[model samples]
Target: MRKTALLIAAAALLGSVSAQAAEQAIHIDRQPWSFAGPFGTYDRAQLQRGYRVYKEVCSTCHSMKLVAFRNLAQPGGPGFTEAQAKTVAAEYKINDGPNDKGEMFERAGRVTDYFPSPDPNEQAARARFNGSLPPDLSVIAKARGVESGVLRGILNMFTQYQEGGPDYIYAYLTGYGKPPAGEELTPTQHWNSVFPGHKTQMPPPLTDGQVEYTDGTPATVSQYARDVSAFLMWAAEPHLEARKRIGFQVMIFLIVLAGLAYYTKKKVWADLH
Candidate 1:
């Protein structure tokens, strides 16, 4: 009787675990990013469009505190000219240190200045968002990722699939919609199919025809999401291209060295035999 009772309890526990897993299962489709494989690099035009989307929409709440204006003109980035970067910087009013009068002052932003936060501080940000603080977007692409199951994780290891972050971001941006039947959300909560809990404090941030693209890209919510996600990836790893190049070179060198070592060993063994 005791053994039967233990078995029943174990079955119930397994059932509960399975139910929770089903509730939390979020399927995020992989996106075909320009910077996906070993030899891949970021697309300049796409990054530029992504920046536009962020500036016009995401920047209103999210702060990119780690990015400097000069980075926009750097190699392997959004392809802005130095003058253009300077112009972009000048549009922002940066808070400066105390002047000779020991009073805090505002000044035109310089290329060296990092992008300022949308809110002055954490308290202000929380107050603006109904007690939910907006996350800094500087490295959000690197910070957030989806879990690939055991089989998919093994495949990703072999295929060099390092795009989980961008895939999650893209899925999340496009996942907002009405809650499923029987799933109720409060006014402060929005439904996102890709979000971990299927609910988020952030509402639908993008709409159709929201940001203008001079490059003739479609002004749709999906396009905006793709662009901004790509831009965030670039921000998280500005040196990705260079890193890949160096890794490739090292692999080639190792291959050549291995071949030489094998031939030399065979020659030495042949003479001894």
Candidate 2:
């Protein structure tokens, strides 16, 4: 009875959350992603490309302070070799403490360093973006996206359609264009179909051939958006693949244990009869 009551309470909470999400009435187009199922894994090559997109383009404005340079060389990530990661780290300059002079100095980034922000503080960031502060990319992918409705959430519990973050990112990136016939945008605002207000302060950030791709992939706007979105998703959840792997193992164990318990119960009851 206690378990049943807990289940009912959970259902009610989920229903409220789902209803709230529906009331917002936002539309986010779904996209195909490599990591979308029980056995889903990050595509190393894709992650590398996504990193390139972020480094060449997104890093100019957004900071990923939570991620370390060494993460690039870690397993289940962008798959950069340690040497490559070190080389990439060296490309950026980081501020370090005084060397006996009580003065700060700039030096090449180390693997332990976090990605630097373009501005020194929020005031500077707002000044750069016309009074709007740029959000951190550390967990933007996970931060975006809507909750699934009650019915869809239940289905997702089984099917694992957990591409909401990447899908929303892709859609938002590609969702920019001119506003409708009568719609007017403020001077600092740009039209975005997927943005909550249909207008956002940030302008469209990508274009065809905006970032040169070393991997021979076409540098289309859509491609850049998708790649960077995937990269950001990985940044937000570096252990996603491992988590899914462990989850599957646990599920299998539970199923096997349940089967064994059923058979054992039958055997004990049979002897009694």
Candidate 3:
């Protein structure tokens, strides 16, 4: 009888704990991920495809306002060439020279100029965002910690770009979901990611297999997410490759030293034993 009671108690305790865990744990549900490469590096073709998607589909509403044309051709960048980068820059006009007469006016873009930000300052930005502000995406992949190694660094670049997607950028871009079972959304309130408390104002950005891809990588929503995430990762941390190389050397040295220490300890302890 006592054992039965104890078992019942244990089961109840476990159930309670599970319920609490479910309630308290915030599931980011990091949209599903496939290994881009061994450690997370994406293929060049994937990155380019994602860029095309961004140019064709995504850039319409959100702004990549901080990057520059030259950055495209920079080391560890999109690996674009100077001519290609310049052409891309020319496609988007940035404020440049003074307009008619002596007065200044918005002019075309140059390779050196950074992308324009959506807002001039924080207050205006927040007002536009419903007391929230969209972040600058230049370093978002890296800032979000996807730039751990060569593959991860590349993959993290676009971690914010896909669905089954839990990230803010992804959520922000592909906004809209029905409200919970009973609760209702106000006309203006968007259903938020389960993490943050807001319905995304941004609308769904892609149709299934919306992006035209030549690489023959899967063209599913998940693949699109992964590819874009990788691109974003690269954007966020351009020097991660170099950093990864240095870290690898340091890790190798530390491992060798640990082995040496273990052997020396064994030798020293042998006499006592």
The number of the candidate with the highest TM-score is 1
* lDDT to native, each model: 0.92, 0.88, 0.62
Residues 1-273, candidate 1, lDDT per residue (tens digit)? 999999999999988876776665578898999998999999999999999999989989999999999999999899999999999999999999899899999999999999988999999999999999989998999999988665677999999999889999999999998998999898999999889888899999999998988888889999999999999999999999889989999999999999999999999899884
Give the winner by TM-score: 1 or 2. Answer: 1
User: Across residues 1-273, which tens digit of lDDT does each residue of candidate 3 receive?
Assistant: 999999999999988876765564333435433322223333566667768776766554446766777877886556789998888878765655566586657766778977666566778877876776666667675454211333444676566332222153443344445677877766546675542555555445666678778767776665565567666766665665556557668889999999999999999999994
lDDT of 2: 0.88
Better model by lDDT: candidate 1 vs candidate 2: 1
Judging by lDDT, tell me the better candidate of 2 and 3. 2
Count the clashes in each prediction: 0, 0, 19
lDDT tens per residue, model 2, 136-194: 99999889875566777799778878788888889888999999999998899999988
Q: On a 0 to 100 scale, what is the lDDT of residue 143 in model 1?
A: 97
- TM-score result, candidate 1: 0.90
Q: Indicate the worst ten consecutive residues by lDDT in candidate 1.
A: 17-26
TM-score of 3: 0.64
